[model samples]
Target: MTSTHATGEIQSRDRAPGELTLRAAWRWWLPPALVALLLALLCRDPFAGDWDALDYTVLALRGAPSSMLFGRTLFIYTNHYAYKLAHALFRVQPEHAYLLFKYMVICESPLAIIGMWAFARRLSGSRQTATIAALLLALSPFFVIYSGQAMTEIPSLVLLTFGLALHLRGMQERQTSFVLLSAALLGLSVNVRESVALYGLWLVVAPLVYRWKLDARTLGLTVAACALFFVCALGPFALIYLFDVDGYRAAWHGWVASMHMEEAAHPVTPYNFLPLAFFFFVAAPIVFIALPFAIYREWRTRGLSPLFALALIGLIANLSLITHYSAVINGRYQLTGLPGAIPLVADFLLRRAQARGRDLRRAFWRVVVIVSLTALIIGTPFMLFAWPTIQSHALTKEYRARLALLPDDAVIMAGGQTVAVTYYRGLGLGRWDVIGTGGGWPGARLPELIDAHLRAGRRVFVDADARLWFTDSWRGAETRQLVALQDRYHFRRSADALYEIRPRTDATAQDEPHLERLLAKPASKLRSLVRH
Candidate 1:
């Protein structure tokens, strides 16, 4: 009787916590989902808040160019078809389609929170710890901001965290199917955001670090499954490289040229440390505060758990890559690693609370509440008030309205707002050219191009204060050029940050043949003149 009871106890203890009843599952997940949904709806921005938001929007609304499909192909296509489906099924108006897309993006936040909860639950085996971790992520300003934007980051984050959860579950149970599916999800995530490649690196190194030699057959199966799934998921992109080599090359060159321009404009400095600084100080300061304690506890106990190791690896790899390569340190980049780190922080807090007794646990909960409320208080106002006031939103709205007022045949000589103006004018419209004074063109030549356009009987408009043209390296020269152009041409303020260049009454028209030749140049060639 005693032996049977002992065996029963052992089996019950070893059974996976994941096999929860439906009611129990709901209890575990519902709070985080509700909180995430509420926050996402409250913070949602009606406009594209980031520069790349409209780029992606345009690609989705219209099909992508061959060169554009070289990266983020899945994200682009998914949004494209999603919009089509919504329009077909619901008869959504074209004007309201972008708003629908934004709402679709917003829905990813709640899904991401649920993924985080599952990942933390699998990692820590404590419902309370997982809930805390989920809440932490839901409240993170970085997560909240990106969640509301129609961008790749939050969607990729959803894939990554869910994959991590499945990967952990598979590793613990020695399940080949789960491991392979996780590998496939991770591979798909890389298609959305290349930065997620580092998470795959951690998974590859994990088996060796954890010493899974005791389960040799399971380990072999895991390896083969991962290899097969990754190949299946990533093979399409490889086919693109092989089949359309020219397109791939064009995309690669475009990316490289943009990187060079950004580097020249921004200039690398000690400020490169900003990504790491933001991760530690701003994104989740409470997590960092708890991390040292977690590390010490793990070190003193079992030499650090594999869960903690995964968290550390993810955080280090992501921060290191962004710090080294990215021209600007965006706080949103840190969201890539929080799925791993938040769980560790939660586990540490819960364990410490359990060990120290009731009063200390109450104190810890109070701290968490304080931090959550603080982030909510600060983030809510910024998203509601300050975010809409960002230059991208204002500029895009102004350009859209101004473009409507301009003559259909008017030619726009654009600077920083080139993409915004181009997008608003509709892609088929061709009466526009990016100002290329800084891109190997002599400043004096700008007037000649303007004269050519004016001679062709086209009204020329300029966005003189476009921010992209005045990066640190080119600001001095660009400013001098702008000042000289303003002196020579009578500029009428057409709209915010936009000016109409009235041809001087004394100015003579340039050669008709020269004007015709200038106007005849392909739009692509004109666009290429700017660094892009």
Candidate 2:
């Protein structure tokens, strides 16, 4: 009898804490499904607005000579490399670049979701709570807004989350390999996006949450893991800089100078970091209101996941500070840290609701659900509806209509319409030979380069009224009249005056034989991107 009792007790202890039977596993699928549904709905509209920098980046990826642009930023290299590899493997088609972009988002987004689920499961200690946290991340309007872009933030978020998850797992199991894996992830995260600089620091700085106890050996091992991670992740870039000293110096100086100028100017007021900080940080009430309450409720059952909490606060606060210093208040820059933040917030809310057991319990849960649902309802329009509708959102339909009227195989002097031109050509709507001037590519020259293309009998498309490209008065009224009189090129009414110029003579026609050959290829046989 004594032996049987001992065996029974051992068996019970060995079983997992929570019973995740088939029914329970099925329930876990709910949140991820909802997340997928929401992202699909938002991406239904074509990506909008012409972001000039994005155009230049995409152009570089599409066979624009690297020698023509400066050395890549941390982000630029990752995005450029990813796109190039994807293109090479699949034979990148101009007509399917948008599809290619969509494939990247759809494929990489799951990493963040999985990361959130793992982080939540570890922190909350309940599969149910973790599922809710993962769902919240998937359903967030902020995430939905960014998931379809050809940007590096989402991938960065994935790396950070994965790193955090590995760290948590290592701590739980007392495993050295997991710790090293975490460090490797943190290293990769920093390179993937510079904003993850904060996350890398947090790994070193955040308090170590010891469930049991730690000796000097454990501490030393942890520090060694961090050092190894930094070396592994950053070694390649360091070597590149060491060998290419002049190039690295020039790129760094130019980048820092541009960033400083942008910060000093602070052109975007009202919406910059100072204001958004309230929504994300200081008002802490907005993002972290439930944190303390959840901490209190779980205090008896589970002490706060202190390291994760501190990491959350540090990453967010740092991002807000950086955002304030930027010229514009772009929310996407902080997205790399969001994979971890969403789950922390969600777990807090769910735990608080679960704690209030009897008195007004229904009302309390109702309120929690209402606020979450309200955030989605109110935030959706801003992220999805309004964003895509703005003329500056990406490229307005107006720009597309105007660009369509130009010759399909003409070299054009373009500065501002790189994004629009890229999208139109990538979509098979039209193809124009592009000679980009502004927005800073590697070998970008001024009007001298434009002169070369134009003098060689190529059609030129100046930014009819773009002050950034020419002297303020150059694109003024008289210039518009002069462009019209100069021959077959004229500014057609676009959504916002994106000019469409055409060849007026055959002398200009023969200048782009390569463009003619590409144009002759059927759109159907062009790149068939695997869209998500």
Candidate 3:
């Protein structure tokens, strides 16, 4: 009877001091969500970027683009449709659809933060580490900025984080339901953004690496789960096949062709580190600093690293792939795997803080203060108020002016970077025929396309801005085509960033005197960014 009583007592002792209950979870999650929502609301008047154009196009689409989505799959249409539902339900316009999307994105911020916290707590068994990880990632610049926009990255990160948290819980409790739910979430994340499929690597590697050997039954179960994940994430698209299998498959082939390895403009190199630097170091330096230590600790602690192995693998994969495949990589492309790495880093730092704080309370508090301040500064859109970079939110004025100058009826063939302005212009004018210079994909063959459009009695206006084509996307061909198009149509610069194709050669460029002062604002912002 005494032995039975002692066994029960031991079991009770093992019931974690702060298990993730509904109330406890809400406390950790609620504040960050509110703050994120508030900030997102303040960042109104839809910022100019590729996502803005893409969202606008999606809003206007009558149906899905077969198997081709954001050059991956048609899953992003889900968010677009969600916003469309909002537009219909709320009786808001296309512009306001973005606002609705941003607000919804903000809602996920808390889930991401609290999810990170819960996962960290589970992994490291430390509440302090969880808190720091959650807070740091919540206040990350990339996460905040993307969340404030109608973009896919934030949702992907949020879903991925929450999925990891769920997966950890499922394993800890040996519950099959939680594991299935976790798989579902991770699958949803990939459909939200294809790049996030990188994190899906963990699903395969985790079971194998965490336990050196597995029985046939377990292996079979793992394969079945993966099949379920694919079906959940992408099987719904099977409905598309119910309509036109040939068209969908062709479109799928086209998108796949673009990603062919040899066609890339650049080679991968040490420059791949940019994502790690831009996404993590710029926003949360402490996380970046603690990564090595975290790796060491996980390695030493009986391969405990598999808990966050997805994060590490995903980050590396993002950097490597983007560097090799993209014409010019943006920090946003690397975001999907970023939050995954933070919890590990946070735990490592928190453990050190605990070690040092054993009789040094004031020093410990000072360290906390510094870390908090750094995160806040990094997360804030200080560049909008202070930088000359394109990321600066103040440049919406320039985009707006460009949109205003373009004629409603003209078939605008503009540069790549000018997509945001062109898309918004087309949306406002109820025209969606705007095409990209260098023909977007056909390059020099754009001249023939232009000839055909002209033959069809369309007023084709060539507006290629060499300054706007910053990336190494089909370099020489685009430059030649730009010259050919300009020679064919007398293109004259109008306003600050707009161009007009005139019938005669005598047309002089119209000037916008206000552009100089407008440029100054962002220039100042860039200066501040550099100073920081």
Candidate 4:
């Protein structure tokens, strides 16, 4: 086995003698930036897609209260403050706040690209390898898609890659300040997205990978560093608790309970690893083909560098956590470790090209071209079709117009679109009764909740076609509550699957006939009305 430290050894062997000039650095930076800009332009949408996007948009437009800052407080605050700054300085109108926020968030893509370059360079000690890795990540379809959205994934990734880069560099240079800064950035990343806390495993395993002996002082320092990491991670939450003790405590408990419930709902099994496989094969085919070979080659050559070990550990930890608890398989979930994997693959490919003259070098270029084209081909359809289709379901002007048609005093009962709907038509406009069906209340108690609203002489408008409430595939408590609601009240289709709920006694001759006709439709037909 090689005795020198992994990253330091690589740097000593491969890096150019002189520091990279501005012109050379710009050559590396420009491609990823241009690619990100092009993708952002193509995938730009005024509205948010999916539940989290909508929730984030609402939080950005309206500042996140203590109740809303469960896992992603920093990300929410970042967007919120950005919006506030734009509104104050740039004179951005309220109507355009989300659009501005979307672009601002999208900017993280280029920053992430640059961060990946720095990280990969630090790992492989080759600017060429780093550039290739950055471009590869820039072209990633899932990365491109998420980049143009108002979400935390890309920002978290940006912080994570940069933090890892600094940490690696600090270890290489023996700089305590760099290490401490890396810890701070990592902690902030945990605040942005709690999923990043998984990377803490990498930090713990890192010293051991560098072949540090398991002695008392080493163990004590490791423990102290980890303690510092946790303290930094929890610092924002601590401040939040200090300001709003009850609210923070309630949110924390609720988040923990939801996590438990989610864990129970999606128990870990052998099949859970399928998503990790899917991430490699479907999401990043190049990495799928290259990473194993890279690991094998590196293992045989230098006995597994700290860089390779970091990548492998990060990939395993992230994939394990996601598959164990998350019900859905998403490419974004794998992104935290994807940057790390890219460096290893890039280093391997570049090394191969250098070692084997002409033909193998041609093969390396061919692989890059093929992989880039494949990623674009796979991602283009999603960028053009799937993303827009999802965004269409957001609280667009059309949906808002339909909502405006309802009585001024009407209370909206929504499911997944609850945040968006409430944001558009909630207490700000004096309509404070947008009840979310996902309030964790019992289905049996749904009637009692509705009865109170009705007794107060407010008309209740239920989103009958909301996917959460009406999907036949869903057999959750929400669906049961919807069925119970149907059996108890006479539903008058107000506009585009929006139904006005009234008591059975209140059903006049005109209402009764319409209600009967609506009820006569088959279950499939009713579900067909859902926009999903």
CA RMSD of all predictions:
8.2, 10.8, 6.6, 5.0
Q: TM-scores of all models?
A: 0.80, 0.65, 0.75, 0.82
By TM-score rank, best first, the candidates go: 4, 1, 3, 2
For residues 1-532, what per-residue lDDT tens digits would candidate 3 score against the true structure?
Answer: 3322332332343246555553555654566556655655554324533444344344434334434443323334655577668667877776545445556666666666666666666654545556666667666665666666656666677777778778777766766677778888887776666666666666677667556358786576577667767775666556555555437657655656654523344455565455435544655567666677777765665464553575477457545554443413345565555566776676555445545423223433554566668876655554354223435334433454555565656676554544564546545643535665332445656767766776676665544443444323344445455555544555456544456554434456332212222212222333233324
Q: Superposing every Cα of model 4 onto the true structure, what RMSD results?
A: 5.0
Better of 1 and 4 by TM-score: 4
lDDT of 4 at 255: 65
The parts of candidate 1 lying over 4 Å away from their true place are 1-23, 65-70, 93-95, 209-211, 214-219, 229-233, 245-248, 323-329, 359-364, 374-395, 409-416, 426-431, 436-459, 464-481, 492-498, 502-532
Order the candidates by lDDT, highest first: 4, 1, 3, 2
Model 2 TM-score, all chains together: 0.65
Model 4 lDDT per residue over 1-532, tens place: 2212333343555456543432457776678768876886676554754457666666566665334334477787787788889889989866566677678768778888888888887777766677778877888776777788777778998998889888887767756677767877888888877777777776687677767678886576567667777877887787777776435677767867865665665566876566556555545667777888988877877775876786686567556654544524355676766876888887776666545443433644665676678787765654454553445555443456666778876887765556656656532443536776443433567788788888999898877553434333333445565656656777677777677888877755123213223233334331232212
Candidate 1, 219-335: lDDT as tens digits: 676677668656745675677667654366667567667666656655666765654564454567677667767666655554656666877776675566544444243566777
Candidate 2 Cα errors over 4 Å, as ranges: 1-26, 44-92, 205-207, 211-214, 245-253, 267-273, 278-304, 311-320, 323-328, 358-368, 389-418, 421-532
- Distance (Å) between predicted and true CA of 85, model 2? 7.1
Identify the leading candidate in terms of lDDT: 4
Off by over 4 Å in 3: 1-18, 31-35, 42-45, 56-77, 80-88, 205-213, 237-247, 257-263, 266-280, 308-311, 322-324, 357-367, 376-409, 416-432, 435-456, 462-532
Error of 3 at 107 (Å): 2.6
Q: Between candidates 1 and 2, which one is better according to lDDT?
A: 1
Displacement of residue 270 (Cα, Å) in model 2 is: 10
